[model samples]
Target: MTLTFIQNIGGGFLIIMLLFSLIYFLLWVYCVIDVIRSNFKDQNMKLIWIVILLFAHIIGPLVYLVLGKNTKVGY
Candidate 1:
């Protein structure tokens, strides 16, 4: 009985870890795509932010999304 309980617990932990990893990976992909699609007047600025996001991990991407430049309309 104890052995079966241990196995069940271990399996549950592994499943949770797998799900978390998939969510993280999807978030990373979305961040990259959103940065690419955003309308920053300066291409350099966009590229710079993308690179920072890719190399800096989760926090880096979040920072760029919140603070990066958006499109500027000139009249």
Candidate 2:
């Protein structure tokens, strides 16, 4: 009985992990695309942002969006 209960909990945890992974991947993609499409004052800035996003994983994108991106909504 205890074994079955433990298995059920493990299955649920696995499903949750998969879901989180999917979300993380999608967010990463969106951040990369945004950095590519965005206009910056310096021509090389976009390249730098892309490199950061690619190598730094989740934290990279979050930091860029929060600190680096321009607040103007039009672009």
Candidate 3:
């Protein structure tokens, strides 16, 4: 059977979802803290990033990592 099929048969699906949710929460917290502590060229950008992190949830941290790191004071 396929992995998804196996997962759906018992508790595997729940475990997988929970693991992913935990990882996402951890990443979100880390990114939010990083944004708070890092110095940005425009001070307001810090608040903006935090708001984005709070609202965007899934993709905010990812986009920030790929695009926002350049804007930090010392990278």
TM-score to native of every candidate shown: 0.64, 0.75, 0.83
Q: Which tens-of-lDDT digit does each residue in 27-62 have in candidate 2?
A: 888888887777777778788888888889869978
The number of the candidate with the highest TM-score is 3
Question: Which lDDT values do the candidates have, in the order given?
Answer: 0.72, 0.79, 0.89
Alpha-carbon runs more than 4 Å astray in model 3: 1-9
Clashing residue pairs, backbone N/CA/C < 3 A, model 2 = none
Worst 10 residues of 3 by lDDT: 4-13
Higher-ranked by TM-score: 1 or 3: 3
Q: Count the backbone clashes (under 3 Å) in each candidate.
A: 0, 0, 0
Q: What ranking emerges by lDDT with the best candidate at the front?
A: 3, 2, 1
* Candidate 1: segments with Cα more than 4 A from true spot: 1-9, 69-75
- Per-residue error (Å), model 2, residue 21: 0.6
Judged by lDDT relative to the true structure, which candidate is superior, 1 or 2? Answer: 2
Q: Against the true structure, candidate 2 has what lDDT?
A: 0.79
All candidates: CA RMSD in angstroms? 5.6, 4.9, 4.9
